[model samples]
Target chain A: MSDKPIALDAMGGDHAPHEVVAGAVHAVRERGLSVVLVGPPRVLYEALEDHRATKEVPIVRADEALAMDEGALASLRRPRSSIAIACHLVRQGNASAAVSAGSTAGIVATGRLRLKGLPGVLRPAIAVALPTLPKPTLLLDAGANADAKPEMLVQFAHLGAAYAETAFSIGKPRVGLLTIGGEAEKGNKLTRRAHELLTASPALHFVGNVEGHDLLTGLADVIVTDGFTGNVALKTMEGAVQYAFTELRNTVNAHRAARLGALMQRGALRDLQRRLDSEAHGGAVLLGLTGTVVIAHGSSRAAGISAACQLAADLEKGGVVTRIGERVASTHRTHRLW
Target chain B: MSDKPIALDAMGGDHAPHEVVAGAVHAVRERGLSVVLVGPPRVLYEALEDHRATKEVPIVRADEALAMDEGALASLRRPRSSIAIACHLVRQGNASAAVSAGSTAGIVATGRLRLKGLPGVLRPAIAVALPTLPKPTLLLDAGANADAKPEMLVQFAHLGAAYAETAFSIGKPRVGLLTIGGEAEKGNKLTRRAHELLTASPALHFVGNVEGHDLLTGLADVIVTDGFTGNVALKTMEGAVQYAFTELRNTVNAHRAARLGALMQRGALRDLQRRLDSEAHGGAVLLGLTGTVVIAHGSSRAAGISAACQLAADLEKGGVVTRIGERVASTHRTHRLW
Candidate 1:
């Protein structure tokens, strides 16, 4: 891979400009990776001063930025938005990849517009790697398309299969369709049709239908579903994890000995927390794009932003796009669904 | 109500007959409840011998029973099934309520066939009380109908609202439509349409829309969605809780101090576990039926079976069916939806 740096959206996320710049500097210094910050020159330059990285990390000026509260339309409204500029950098080969912690809708919309989709790719999917036993499970369409056709789901399976092979090195990745029941006949109209298509497809190692409970059990390498259900399932799992920890903390605090014990084993507990943390994986990747586009968590700080940069660089090196494109093209040719 | 007993499916669940008979005896002596065990007379009588409950708990013969793996079709195939007989007891006024731990689909199909729906009810929904802070949040359509129309969701909200009010004593219970986003227009076609209808309905205290993460936050008294999404969400939450506990256990056992601390705080931890246990809520209630019907977990033992019976008896006393009927009647009359 060329020494093309990852373009970081500086004016994005909750602690943007500063945290993002700090993360870029951390990547360059700690991880030995090149990064280019994208945002207004004055704002980014001032933020980079804290890390003494003004000269080390290059800055690409983006005049306007989409508000955090804005939707997909903001990508069109602010053509020079930090996320847009980051995508442009990837498109122009100035950067190997784009990483942004901006509004999910805005980033997805702009990435689609700037990088476009792989040939025969009906729609791009936001693939999130879930923390499960054995290995991370790849769940796709995590919010890219709220509504999806059966054909799109079949395509998603192939996209996820390729991603698993490239990112996680899972050969012949088993794919499961997310639905209410394990039976193939079960689920809503869309799922039933998709189940049939997936079962018939030769490219995907279809494992039939899996319920939401199978998500954390590592039943399949990739779980494919419409973006709405996928997004809800993802968030619901996150909330449950937090709720459990809060309950655990309260239990430990209820007794003195328990609190002392928790203190004693705080190291192991921290390790568990880190392993389960959503930000540890460096955010969701927008797959089926022409380039590697990583969407960092919105509330990410320095560590999360830096992790995302590292992930973008890794995905670029692993050739995720080319793998997905080839897989999609082969599936599209064989199935002729998309 | 009258001295009408709860008709229990002695042929249902993992430890059926024995556990069912034991639970009946427990419910009678501990809670002062009338109970009738429905199964093959010989099997129930032989099992009841262990508890010396043969004389204390009445037995009603139901020659046939549905299998654990059976679906909705089994309800018709085995008209004399224990679950069918239990529902028959409810319809015949011999039992005020029915409790079963058989296949959910079989119980639902039998209940719909025997008790039928309330006056204005279109489709029945399974309502489960989620273990959440403040109070258990009621989630409906846990898997009765895999597919639902937009208007069906409107009815589900009213069903859930009535259940929440009757079961939890929440007045003007706020109902939330489950969606991908908090915005009214953020979900797919069904959810988006349901959101609009819910927002317009004067019969409900609709609280816009809630994401999957809101399931355990007690954000709304009742969360309503299509059966498929609701089932997936409910199972996902359960899976997440189990995963967290497993992880916590591993962390606690990682060191001697942590294990000792866990032992010292076992009381508080047990209380938390009980509070979060789905079984503690006495399983799920099938709503919109003419009579109250509670479906215990299929793997439920004696204590869980007793809890389900208690829940059925409580719902009968709470007038859940009557309340739902009146609410649906007025709403249907007001909107002419039916």
Candidate 2:
């Protein structure tokens, strides 16, 4: 719906090139979205021909790609990487947004270099939408700022609130501080200070502290914490979910009766699985950037890539950056504590 | 096995004197362990009479009892509380260990106030055994110290290693510091410093850094972290498991075939559930204390209480506290950095 198409990094992700190209084609055909695949032109051209749609999706040539195992230094080492080229496309107004299932550190470093930050933004945060019941819960600072000042966390609340309002269409989204206890005085120094600031800020609809058990209870629209804590909590939950599913599978196949039962209830089980899937919510988002950037999971398949494109497009169209700018502008006028 | 009985707080947990008395009886009759019920004699006597266990377990008199919701301050307020009396009994050598299905903060506070700490031990940590495949993983500092120093983490590793050696009979337990990355340099100030200290300590078998996702993979025998992060990680996994089982139950009830299959696989499902059950691990153990102390879940029933008693008895017999004292004494001699 924007003037420019979304630029997809075809050389990113665990199953790069092949799965990425297939996702691009699927998005074009199924969702009626315009996409530009950025990678080696010859490889992309051949893949597009194999999909039997060479003319529909265009390819932009990029000589190199950031390795999956590389860190922030990769952004500098491979300036012409597919992810870098995608960011360049967004910066030049040739693309509405950028989506990549690449190394998070590399994507973040390059995004900052290319798109830069909006005015008054201290640091960009990664917000992952948890597939909780009724509606999804957005957890911010998933991994961007490993060490954070109290002001950064308060800013994350504003950023998360804006994303929740735009993406989930919620009015005055309630923001909760992720800490050890329900009381405001709980948690380490960073969380305690941030809690006080968030409470005083008129922009965020601040709720009391929330524990890890509240993540799936849909207790808050936005949960804010330091990147280190957030990242640990997220990964721990993900791994536990996998373990539970494994146990469930082993139990279901224990006997003929359970197997038959599992087959009959297969529809409901699949629905629940889809609802809880991380890909359903797209991926972790980098907030506070000048342009919309979505970093999909490194192991994401075609479905995840398509959802990442959808998330990037929706964020751009919804004016998330403009909303953040307005919030920062108002905070500057009223509170100068930070 | 020891000459002394395991003390149980009869007025603790959701089920109160009834479940506690029943659990004490079960520990004696089923597990061949001696247990003493600590509470008001009249209240405990009547409950024991109801279970026909009046003659099986001995009753210890305590004038006051700490409420399940009461915290650290309760130790000062109710000096004669059942939990405080249990700790006193252990210190007096009348009871080899203390087990309470009560507030973790209350138990930790009272245990510190009554039993004191081993020499050279900085702070006590609560270790929970995670039911990972192949073996149970021990996670320490599980809500004992909300704020910890770098040196405290290193000490925690030593404490956890001692526990793993004594309880699981492992020659040299592998210790992992829970952090964001496997690389040594990828954490906040606390973890970074702790990693360096742990690596340098000759007493522990340091296995470098382990991420949150590695909690259930049996990657290490002992995982050491600050109490706040450990509690969050543990509770998050518990919540996710609950959600998964709920979904599984819903799917099984979706149709007749699934229901029949679930019925057929009932034994295997129950076995898996029992293996993953928190109560089966016999609650969290308080290390670095002068005497063995186990804190059970607040909602624990008769079975969970009995398991906690079993854990307390096992730790006391295995001389977990003695092993910690030896480790601390050696670390004091060589690793004077802490």
Candidate 3:
């Protein structure tokens, strides 16, 4: 088992300390991973006691708690909040990584503000593993910064490439720029400039422009875009998935034959469901930070939280942060971006 | 049955005269709709003969043909092309409407240049019916113009609202400006300004900003957006649907039980598939034009073309163009953008 510990924000997410504590217990007992729960001691103790895991899990008392509604300013105002404290633990070497199922914006702001970014990094990007055909494709800038320069997108590509290589163990991951069309000159000014920069960059395996359809076909291992388009694309895909599954469920329940078929196909359906489940892969990771930070979904349950912890541990063990810093530094040193 | 005739661009679309001729025949025989094939008479005659229905479908002689590869400039240069000829027929009272499975940009440009816009309209908007839950949702400015000012978006909303009310029969169709979030101040500069303009306009049923997720949920009856974002969102949704269905097919075929279930649930599955199929909706209509012009998919088959013809007939019979003209004229008379 790994000796490295993860600092988990127990007061965050929809289910709060109960599900968070239960998830931590499962990670400790089943995954054999250590976790430091950072939240109000009283509430966390009660939650841990409910799972009969008081002695098993350790609580790092953080009196201040940031609500999910809090914005980026909350990170500055409440420096010792649960999520901030979690990041602080990682910064102070008390924890190897930080796991939080909080507001994406809040987590990103806190992570950047608290842990700070690595040397030579322009900006941190949020990379999400989309379960596509054959393999899971990594999409970056899921919702980090809304406005991005062409140079920032190129940096995002490098960050995504390093992530794919480390997290998925893919060799020479192909990076593709998300655009309206596959044609070289088919997007807005940003995409056109990014395409030119990406193609010219020797550090990345830049495959040309890829349309939205290519997101789930494993056309490229690492897909990079500005946060605005990337976030919209990701959310649109999620919405479509939910709508489809809802329609599928209704169709399956429409008649006796469908019901019987649904029953017979339960195993395969479960497999498909599991494959598409965002929670299974954990939430998106904020890359370019000094330490690994995994941000699970706000609505995550125990299983999702456990999966997030496992992902955070795996990322730490995989040397993701160090690899990203090295890649950025090497690229900056060799090829300067004007 | 309706006595009005539709001018069909026979030489357009991927399959061209073959599918176009077949779709015309199907419309006459199956849907009881009248259509005049606008293309080279000899080629259309040969195609009609192959379908064994030369006498069933009438052919209109047009010497020029618009290649699918042609861009917007081709609309001005190739004045007598098939699509232009079709729109000309509509303008001359020879046909009630025009339907073409040709180049979308060419069709939009030709419709505006040839048929012209309704009085008081800024620019025509392409409105596509997205297959959302419960009912279909209408999205406008799919690709009419790449860049749009805030005033243009407000006009597009009116255009979409007119379409939803006339075509979908939705009363007071709630209009939404498609953006990154539901907040009034959550999008880019254009969207922010568009939101304010839409809310202030009494001509529309402005419901604030709706995110991409709302596209599939029928949150708003008429979704308005700038042409670039709308086109991107539409294509993204189409690509996502294709990816999802592909993934589902693989999952269904992976196991024996799932295969058995697939057989039993085939009917419901088919229904769901048809609902999600873009072709089933009879392509996107370029609204705010003087005459009804339906731009079918470039890769449309016989059924899709026939559906487009039927849609054109329906819109024409419903007096869509007249209503749109009145709406725009009144809105412009009261509150002029210029």
Candidate 4:
């Protein structure tokens, strides 16, 4: 529908070019989205041929690929890495957005090194959509920067707010600082200082401190935390969900009545499964970058990759990068941190 | 059938005398556990009279009550407080254990001040039973000490291991240090150092660092962390469970087929609910105490309180206090931290 094409890091993720190329084909065929697959040309063409989609999905030659085991420094050195080349496409106006399912550190590092950070932005933050009640809650700094200053947390809030508004169409999203308790001074020194900083930020709809319990209750549209806590909470919730479903499956098979019940409830159960599936929400977005960059799960399949491409296209159409830049610029103009 | 009686802090929790007294009656009548209700006799008797259970439940006279608003100092000043009196009963060998659904801080303070910590124990840590698969996982230092040293974390591992062995009947429980990641060097400085200390400890089954995702997977029988992270993780998991159920309810009610499906899956749903219910496992136990003290939810109802009383009695029968003392005494003989 739109002329803007997405740069797909075909060499990234668990399935590499095979699933990535299939996902690109699906996006173009089913979702009517333009995508330029970036990876080793021969490998990507073969993968596309396997899907009988080589003619449909175009491939951009990228000689190098950043392995999943590599660290952030690898992204800096390997400028020709698949994710880096994808970002370069976005920066060079050949593509509107870049999507990768490689190592998070690599994506964040390459996004910053290649596309560069937005004007006035202190640091880039990773925002993941949590499937919370009423809607998906946006949690920022999921695991980008572990040791962030209080000022950096404030910027994360602004960045999360912009993403929530643009991606979810949530207007003036209520932001809450993640802490141990709901009280103003309950958490460690970092949270205490962040609470004050967030409350003072006029750009954010600061709702005060929210405990871990508030993350999924729709207590706030945007939940901001230092990467340390946010990463733990996010992973904990994901693990719990997995455990619950596993238990639910076991419970369903425990008795004949339960088995029958499961059969009848299959539709509802599938809907619930879809809602809880992390792949359905695409993946984490590296915010504050000059270009839109989405980092999918490393173990992501074709569905997840396609979802990530859709997410990247949506973010590009929504002008998330420009909005984040504007918000950072305004915040810095008022209260400069860097 | 147990001869040992538990002293219930009647003037505690959100519902106070009503729920506590009702729970006491239920424990005695249903579970056959002897209980001595500790509170202001006049008010407690009136509450009992209202339930027509005065003759069934015996009340122990305690003139003062600790307000939920009060902190640690309240335990020292109000020596005659209900929770303090409950702990005193255990100290005097009149009651085998003490159970309170009051302020955690108040209970911890009263237990430590009135009954004192186990010999050579640096601090008492709270251990909560996580309803994980196969077997329940034990998470220690749920909120007792916010900022724990590496030594304290090692101590918590021992305490949790002991509780898991005695209470859960698990032998040589696999102890995992709860950190941001499963890798040994993946967490904050404290975790990295604690990993070394825990692995070096001869008393525990140190299985290395376990991430938040491992909590519900039963990766380790005993999971140890500082109170701050443990409390947050526990609450976060609880919140996610609540949110998941709420969303499931909404999804079921959305259409006729889904509603019919819900009716069919009602049995399995009830089973899942019972398995996920934290109250069924009773309250969190404050480990490393000279006396067995259990802290129930502040808003616990009759069944929850009854479960706490049952848990306290079970721990007492299993010699939780003696075992904790033995662990602390042994740890001291080797490391000499105290």
Candidate 5:
């Protein structure tokens, strides 16, 4: 059991204090998880009072909060921001993990500066679980280091593999290098060199290369790429899914028979949507940090926030941070790249 | 008017020779387009015979063929390969364009080497039409230059704009920089720098930065990015769509009601698939080259090949290569980055 509560940034995300407070209440009441809301006292208190859960969750007062539109520089400028304060709580061992739905840039930048990286972590990465058959595939450096060296990619592979092993209980997770082609030689200069390093590393169960199409096929348990490519790929998948659903809805509406058919299968269709929802997976986990950190979707509502808190608590309980530390340390010892 | 036939690579793709021959036959008989098949005479002649159109479609003898598994270097090694021969026909003024359902790397490399880049073009890029509403959004650097200079991105904008204007009849195509965030400063080093250059260029109606989610939303008429990210985004979209459909199929089959509904709406669902098919857009076009080139999907069947040939002929007639030449030259003169 986690002794420390999850430090939640109440003022982060588009929904802010209201949804965040509701989510905190749900986590405490429904999920039985300890959570500490971090934001301006009066605003958060009023929001929590709306749900009549002021007694259930504790408050860590922080006057300043990073705006949703603010970028990474805001992390440095607004040191007392809600996200920063949440990170501060985790750093001080008052909390087990930091959960935020603010600007990804701000969360990543603040987490790096506040919680700091693990012993051998070059850069903290964002690891996301992609919904796939059998189990989810973990993709990393989802947006942490936009520009990455070949060595950083090798570290990402380890980070992703360790997380998959710890989080999904998969032994020897097959690591893959994401690039343009399935062939080893096909990619940009960065990926080409990274492929060579990944292939040479004995620590990983290296699966040569996986194309973008392979991301959802469960071809590899852990797929590693630079933050830029990873971010684009993630967003592209989001957009594609949204577009397809829109098209499907339009198709169902175009004809009388289709409409009747869709009505009959409505429950099943909704279930499929729920299974593919990012919020259900607890958003994206920021790996390689000194403490457990979960960055929920910026547009997350009450349910998403609650799911993120649950994930943060689960990751803390699973010892993902320590597992990552051990894996990185062992790999570094064998490879001597660091 | 296109003066010569489109040079088709017969010994390319998974269903090579047979499907390629059938497509060529379809182009001549159905689409009213002229096409010349390039491959081994004995094999191609026999393939043409199977279609019973040996005399209808002419054959260009090329003893060698690049295997589907071959990469860019294969373009250099096998000068007589079907794809290489197709490019040679375009270079020699015997064909108006080159059409191939071959290895993209082999096609792009051979196209660059044989057909060559235009005078002001920095690097030739592959442009694909995304299946969106109103009109398809054109995404470039689809797989051409894995690595790109900021200046090269400016050239891509011009290239894409010209193609959109000529191909889609858009007088001023709005160009968007594909990156992680919608803000100008939100991408990696390459995209950030490219954003600055794209914003400064007067030749483009640059609408500023767009995210992966915007790819299908039709926010911008032309979206430009480095080839690595573009290729990944494209494939990711493809994978996501395929996965969604697969899940929908499972959802439909899960319940008797859903199955009955799906049966009733089968026609509408099939129509939806056709609307989103890559083959319907005539595959992807290689721009900024001296000669027009079309690279069909590697697994293209007769219909895909025919669509690619028709697209190749249309692009040749539209003078996309010349339009791109003028656009790049004008931008280079104004910007002076090259």
Candidate 6:
């Protein structure tokens, strides 16, 4: 990771170039990291000028932008979209990584088309860090491959394990299969087959099947599942957290004594919220690709964008892409499903 | 539904023959619901005597008992298991409904084997009422069928709709297919086909696809999915709620002001907990069967067991079984997959 600037899609996310430019300014001034904003020069230059960071961060021109509501087809519809240009910079070795808060489908499609998957990698997986006690757990195939084969699930385990090792610096990360039951003989055909394959693989520290309740328990360092299940579980957790806080707020506001108590412990509650915040963790990372890519939340502000930039830089510095490539190649050869 | 007693599996659950017996006593003595305890005569008699309701609740002899750890196979291995006897009572019209705080797999297997599926049900599904705002959302195939065909998903929709109609008194409940994306074109093969079938049916109030975030948002009255995804999503929500409360407790206890506020708002917090507690909702109902059966949590206490009994009686009294039978038969005939 030669001091190459991280390429960011300034036109992506709900807040657009303003928040994205502010984040780049923060990364350069506070974090001392090089960053290149990819979007229309006129709009980005004004955004950077608003933060007085015109001289600090560089700009790359991208004519088209992918809309938040757009899907994978938008990647082809807009060839030089902001996210596409960001990936182009990374693929061309002009940038260390690509960070975007664009539509997940568009980013994933553009990533696959531009950056391409690593050698022997079946498909790219979206790895999310679950805020858990002791250490955060990694869940893979968050939404990248909705319909996956048993072989793909095994590949996701390898991808997730390598990610946990790189991001969290864990040794021999324990991987678990996410299914309905905690038994080898349980689950649908795909998981049951994947469970057997995972157990047989000497390279993986495969803990047996873990249920949905084990997601936040830190029972496994990395839990692998199909993209559909992973996406649903991850979103379900987000919804639950949001609902709990909403109910808590209503309860606190209903009584004056409770309100005073909440006000007094507001700092502690804020700390707890920060600890469980997904956006604070830099969103999900797209792994098994040639270059590192971080997909921040669509509603991210400057702080979240900066966090995503830091994560992208960290992964590039840690050589996560190379790690995943080696692990996939070695494990795929030995544990051939065919 | 007649004046027949609700069959209670006294040998099931963690605190079996004691908590189950106590729960039966409460139903008979307080709720004025007729109850029959099914288990070993000696053990049940002792439990009833402890509750001082030996005459209030009748005892039905069942020598064999299904262990809490046993899965579907136990239904066959122990043909005369307490759960089996409870189902027998229902089939013989001696009991209006069967209620058990036992292993979900064992209850589902025994229910299907003894009570049997109604006219056109592909398989029995576990319908759990999610503690959502305004009204509880019904999610089905909680863990019954790990693998389900597209046709089965449609059947689940009908079953869930019927349940919402009977339990919540909702007329023409909206049905949503649980999938990765909100668009009808977004999911895998099974959901894609199910969406088409759901849209084509005149009997269904199909509102299109729903993501995991919609589970607690009350966007749909009945959300249907394959057993594997539903089980995972339901458990994940439970885990998230538990984790949030645990973190909140630690945060509140760490500070004096927070502790005071928590003490002041204790009543409201307890109300919120009761609102979200799955056991309070009488656990998951095994639907799409000939008889009304409620499977309480395996770790249920006396209160939870009593709640399960009340739920079973309510469903029996509401004629939910006949309602589901009519819905399934009509919809299955019109939307024949074959």
Quote the positional error of residue A125 for candidate 1 in Å. 0.8
Model 2: residues with Cα > 4 Å off, grouped in runs:
A255-275, B255-275, B279-281, B336-338
lDDT by residue (tens digit), candidate 2, A77-170? 7889999999999888899889999988889898988887989999999999987766788998888888889999888988998898888898
Q: Tally clashes: model 5.
A: 0
What are the DockQ scores of the candidates, in order?
0.74, 0.62, 0.50, 0.57, 0.81, 0.75
Candidate with best DockQ: 5
lDDT of 6 by residue, B88-194 (tens): 99998899999998888999999988997788788989999987767789998798998999989988988888888887888989999999898878988889999
Worst 10 residues of 1 chain A by lDDT: A256-265
- The DockQ of predicted model 5 stands at 0.81
Please report how far candidate 3 places residue A118 from its true position, in Å.
Answer: 3.6
TM-score of each: 0.96, 0.95, 0.91, 0.90, 0.95, 0.96
B1-338: candidate 4 lDDT, tens digit per residue: 23668999998888998999999989998998999999999998998888788887788889998888777777999999999999999888788899999888889889888887777778899998888656789888887887788999988888887788787899889999887665676677778899988887888889998888888888899888877778778888887776666666566667455444655356766668665774423559988877789998887888889999988888888887778788877877877653
Fnat, one value per model:
0.81, 0.65, 0.42, 0.65, 0.83, 0.80
lDDT of each: 0.85, 0.85, 0.82, 0.82, 0.86, 0.87
Over B200-232, each residue of candidate 3 has an lDDT whose tens digit, in order, gives 888778888888788888889888886766766
- What is the C-alpha lDDT profile of model 1 across B1-338, one tens digit per residue? 55799999999887887777888889998999999999999888888887777788889999999988898888988888999999998998899999998888888999999887888899999989887666678888898988889888888888888877776788999999888877766889989999888888898999889998888888998899888888888778878877877776666675555445547356655667666774424569999988888999887778888988888888888888888888888887888754
- Candidate 5 lDDT over residue span B192-229, tens digit each: 99999888888789999999889999999999999999
Model 1: clashing residue pairs? none
Over 4 Å off, model 3? A1-4, A73-77, A255-271, A279-281, A334-338, B1-4, B30-32, B50-56, B67-79, B91-94, B112-122, B252-255, B258-266, B279-281, B330-338
Candidate 4 C-alpha error for residue B204, in Å:
1.7
lDDT of 4 by residue, A1-338 (tens): 24769999998888887888888998899898999999899888888888888888888889998998877788978989888899999888889999998888788889889987787788888999887655778898887887678888888888888888888899999998887766776777777898988878888899998888888888898888877678878888887776666666566666555544655356765668665775323569988888888988887788888888888888878888878888888887778654
Q: How does the DockQ of candidate 3 come out?
A: 0.50
- For model 4, how big is the iRMS in angstroms? 1.7
Model 6 misplaced stretches (Cα beyond 4 Å): A255-271, A279-281, A336-338, B255-271, B279-281, B336-338
Model 2, span B163-189: residue lDDT tens: 888778888999999998878888889
